[model samples]
Target: MKEIFEYRALLIELVKRDIKKKYRRSILGILWSMLNPFFTMLIIAMVFSSFFKFAIKNFPVYLLTGQLIFNFYSEATNTAMGSILENASLIKKVYVPKHIFPIARVLSSGVNFILSLPGLVLVILITKAPVKFPIVFSFVPVLYVLFFCFGVGLLLASITVYFRDMFHLYGVLLTAISYLTPLFYPKEIVPEKYMFLIKLNPMVYFVDLFRDMVYYGKMPTLDEHLNCIFIIIISLFVGVVVFNMNKKKFILHI
Candidate 1:
């Protein structure tokens, strides 16, 4: 705990560096962050809204709510996994917690995620989704999601240090997980036989919780909410075990 506290300033500095460096030269600058997901939502909304012929009421908000949040999770883990490899030069330069690097990645993505919320609000107003009390009051889900991201980020960061192949597998997992998790489509779309499989994935609950709060303006089922919290706790606990075991070796490998 003291080591983590000692590294706090550097963590803030690294997170700032990541945010600035990510948008240093571009003409649009950080606006690209907002635009990238905006465009993705548009493309998806067009395809699904047209094909299903189901009225995707406020399609952008519906899509962006899920896309923006999920993108944070996906981007944070994938980028953070290679933190040690990416900072090989600094690995030996100073004594700091290696876990801080990947965590910094999560922090950077989280800042962007918060900034992007205004666009979601604009879409919500335009789409006429109810501006409910829960949307304003529900910080609980955000807390859970952050825990989930941190836990997953730590695990991925540790793995990528030892197994370079793990980085490539991250892409494949994201592709498959996106479909399996209910983002663009609803749970009802899945066949009854496969419904159990979707339920088993912990990510499904988080996504559903987000949709319920932002899109449907309803709280998730108590069971679903509790299950997600449980998964986050377990994932973080395992991540810490793996990361602590691997930390000493990270310097040597890098």
Candidate 2:
């Protein structure tokens, strides 16, 4: 931890580089962050609305809430998973905490997520969803996701160094998770038997908590809070242990 704090400048530089690199040739630049989510919600909502019936009120806002939280987790972990290999040359040439690469990727993705918040606000305004003090507490859920990403990102980054196939495999996992999470649909429609499946998925808590606050105008329940705390603790513990144990072997594999 102290090492990261000391090298924080390098971390910040990497984050800035990632942000700029992500949109280097793009015409929209950073603005695309906001538009991407908005358009995604619009398209998903339209397509799903046409195909099936949903009683989910303010479907756009509900979808947006779940979409934004999941997108951040997906983007952060997917990018962070390859962080070690991405910085192979630098890691071999200079000494830096190997964990910083993944951390930087997650932080950079987080910047995009933050920039995308205005789109959510815009949707809320358009939908005229009730905005109350609890809505401001939406940040709590996002913060939970950020830490969740940190743990998952670190573990993936370390594992990918040894097993390159994890890169492709993680993509498949992300696809499955996107569906597993109730992004476009409501939990009410999930069959009773499948409720256990939904409960087992960690993203459920984060997405549902955020949705509860942002879309439903209520604070997250006690169970939601406890689930998040447990997830982060277990995630960080496994990630840190795995990363530290295998970090020395990274040079050979990378």
Inter-residue clash pairs, candidate 2: none
- Native-to-model Cα distance after best TM-score fit, residue 164 in candidate 1, in Å: 0.8
Q: Which stretches of candidate 2 lie over 4 Å from their true place?
A: 50-54
In order of appearance, the predictions have TM-scores of: 0.94, 0.97
- Highest lDDT against the true fold, candidate: 2
Our model 2 lands, by Cα RMSD against the true structure, at 1.1
lDDT of 1 at 87: 81
For candidate 2, write residues 138-184 as lDDT tens digits.
Answer: 88888898988999999999999888999899999989888889998
The 10-residue segment with the lowest total lDDT in model 2: 49-58
Tens-place lDDT digits, model 1, residues 111-136: 88776776677677776777666576
Worst 10 residues of 1 by lDDT: 50-59
